[model samples]
Target: MPGLSRRGERMPPSPIRKLVPLAEDAKRRGVRVHHVNIGQPDIESPEEFLEALRDPGTRIVPYGHSAGLWEYRDGLVEYYARFGIRVASDEIVVTTGGSEAIIFAFLALADPGDEVIVPEPFYTNYNGFAVEAGVTLVPVTCRIEDGFRLPPLSALETRITSRTRAILICNPNNPTGYVYSREELEALRDLVVERDLFLLSDEVYREFVFDGAAAHSVLHLEGIGDRGVLLDSISKRYSVCGARLGCLVTRNRDLLSAALRLGQARLCAPTLEQKAARRALDASPEYLEQVLDEYRARRDAVFEELAGIEGVLAVKPKGAFYTVVRLPVEDAEAFARWLLTDFQVEGETVMIAPAAGFYATPGLGRDEVRIAFVRKVPEMRRAMRILKLGLQAYRGAPARAGDRAGP
Candidate 1:
């Protein structure tokens, strides 16, 4: 048999999905594993969108266009206009998902061995995309103590080289869930403009802002309009992850032209999903409001419960449904595995993604784990109970603690 290519060897398994076999093994042993690892929400998709999919009159399942249905793209333009982002349908190219948008953006704006500056502890899949695109990810450290704010603009300046092509941000970010304030967005705007670098904003969680927080878009910034790329998706907004609908929005004509070429190669994203996405674009504000409220309540419950556990530090997440908790354990990966394989409460255990995967730097996030508060309140409470007990048990083992928390 032939072996895989060098790129295949360089690629690592998705850290999020790497533990699936263990989770399945636990299930085989009759253990009810409460999954807090992934961000797939349990909320219902909008009824109007579902009805659109179920309509008997629906037809034309064939591929619509390389750039997606013209109607859906136009609807998305209107959707953004509501948020003060002015753009035409021509500026948007529908993608299979935001995942593809990221890849296409990199392919369009960067070359092999080029570099992109990203804040540390960002979405892990960015690393995978960087690897696939054959680009280097230049990371600037952002501490959780600071709520993962953009590291000082000066810190980012230090990482820039001639090869640095862009700066990627996930506003109201994943894992830490820190929403960038307008001031911070302006600071980034100034920096990107001064450096002449591309500003790629991943706004998939744009509608999930809590506590009356508003999301700032780089595309909304004045001078940076020609250099910014807005990655939008209907997955989180409509709780329809399987729809696989996303868009790449920009006023940069050259970038859009290049990205369109890439889109043409893939043919078109799903046709039916594009129609459903058009319906989603016109979904009721009340449906999204209710979903936001549910997520906020779950965030509060997780924060409060984690606070009660000694030696656990959890930042109050402002936008997304994830919380990064700093554990007292020596190695979070080992501890996470132990929770799934060795520890159980009432024949159940909590599954979480080790924070190390979220960072590009080696040895960082060693004592941390990213937990998604996606389950219902009752399930979240049960998972927290199991985690609290696991922490206590791990602390009691003298060899494990080694004088860190030993009696």
Candidate 2:
């Protein structure tokens, strides 16, 4: 057989789920796994979403408009308006998911071999998207000691080369849960404007900000009018991961045209899900209020528990439901695997994402793991307890002779 394509070979596996086989084996051997690896919410989706799916109101499922269902886009316009992001339905190209939107943005904004600057320890799937789009992602490192804030504008500016096409950011960032403040955003606005590059902002976790902090949308930035592209989704917002509904919104008609062509190439997003997304707009505001309250409690539980774990370095996440924790282990991935393969406390073990995969630059997150506080507060506390115990046991294990020996 001819060798598998290089692109297929180069694709990075999802670190969030790479340990599934071991977890499955653990389960087969009668161990309970407390999954804090992925960000799948345990909360119930809104009732209106289920109702819309149950009664799709169409006799036959047909291909939607390449841009999206008109009514659905109409609903999205109002939804964006609620965030003070004024966008017309025509400027939006609904995608299969935020993943698709990112890929499409990369396709529309840059050519193969062209570069886009992104902070290190960004969303891991961006690596796959960059691979698929054939674009190069340049990393500007953000330190966890600084609460994962955007680095100095001078540092970001230093990375810009002639081939640099855009600066991509995830507000309420994944893996770190650091919400970018408005001043930081303004500095980005100034940088992108000065460099004449696109500002691709992924604001999927806008509703999950904690500590009374506000998430500033790129649309709200004064100088970023035409240069801004907003990639958003209902998956995390409404707990509809399987629905796969998301959209790319921008004021740049040229970018929208490019994205729409890509959308046409893919045909269209799922039709029924668009209807469900429309109905999701009708969800009571209290739904998110309650959801936010629960996540806040979970976040507190995670931080409070981590504080008691000796040698674990963690900063309390300001937004989103995740935190990147520096573990005491020499190899976080090996420790993560050992948790599933060898360690357990009273028949229970916790699964976490080794944070190395979340970084584009090599060897940055090797000592860290990303934990999602998706479960309820008590469950999160218990999972942390299991993790703490697991750490102690892993350290004392004879297999970690190298860990005990200093460099």
Candidate 3:
């Protein structure tokens, strides 16, 4: 038999889902597992979104334009306008998901072996996408002490080389849930402009910010519109992950054309999803407000419980539904697997994503784990209790006084 190609061998398994067997084993053993691993929200999709699909006025289930339905695209224009991101419908190319939007941006802007700088401990799927594109991911570390704020602009400068093609950022970032301040975004803007690099902003969680924090879009930045590519989705915004409808928006005609060509190759994204997303754009802000309130409650509960844990350190996230906690254990991956495989509290356990997967550098994030606050408040509190109990069960020395609680 022929051996697999080198590229095939290079593909990395999804770190998020790799521990499923352990979870299944735990379940088979009669343990109730509280999942804090992935960011699948428990919120209901808006009624209007479903109603659009149920109306069924059209006779044909034809493929919409490769770029997506004009009405859908136009709705996105208005959707973005609410946040002061001005762009025409023609500038948008709808993709299968924000996952596809990232791939499309990479295909449009990068050649094999080119570099994209992403802050360390970023969204783990980014590693997968970079591997598939054969692009190098240069990571700039952001200290958890600073709530994983983008490291100083100087840190980003050291990673740039001639092959550097883009800078990718997740605003109200994944894994860490750090919402970049306006100053931080401006600092990034200056660097991207100076280096003549593409700026890719993943704003999928734009609506989930808390504590009166507002999200700033790179598209709204003054002169960088030509260099900016905004990756967005209705999945998180509308709690309709199954819809899998996302769009890549840019003011750069050249980039949009290149992305459109890639979209053409795929024919078109899901037609019904596009219609649902179109209706989702018209949903009242109140629907999102209700979801945000629930997430905020969950976040508060998780933060408080983590604070009470003897050896765990976590910051209060300003946005998104994830919290990165520093654990007392030496290797978070080992501890995470042990939690699902061996440890239990009242015949229940919590499954978490090992923080190492979020980092590009080997051996970093070894003592950290990411917990998603997607469950209801009561469940999140229970999960946190189990997490604390698991830590107590681990055979490690206690954390130092001030170190256990961050700055």
Error of 2 at 233 (Å): 0.7
What lDDT score goes with residue 100 in model 1? 93
lDDT of 3: 0.88
Each candidate's TM vs. the true structure?
0.97, 0.98, 0.96
Which tens-of-lDDT digit does each residue in 83-202 have in candidate 1?
999999999999999999999999999999999999879889998888899989998888878877777789999999999999999987987898988988888889888999999999
Whole-model Cα lDDT per candidate?
0.87, 0.91, 0.88
Per-residue C-alpha lDDT of model 3 across residues 35-111, encoded as one tens digit per residue: 98988988889988899889846888888799989999998888888888899999999999999999999988999
- Candidate achieving the largest lDDT: 2
TM-score computed on alpha carbons, candidate 2: 0.98
User: Which regions of candidate 3 fall more than 4 Å away from where they truly are?
Assistant: 396-407
The number of clashing residue pairs in model 3 is: 0
C-alpha lDDT of residue 309 in model 2: 93
Report lDDT (Cα) of residue 34, candidate 1. Answer: 97
> Candidate 1: where are CA atoms >4 Å away?
56-60, 398-407
Candidate 1 vs candidate 3: the TM-score winner is 1
User: Superposing all C-alpha atoms, what RMSD in Å does each candidate have to the true structure?
Assistant: 1.7, 1.3, 3.3
Which portions of model 2 show Cα errors greater than 4 Å? 399-402, 405-407
Q: Of 2 and 3, which scores higher on TM-score?
A: 2
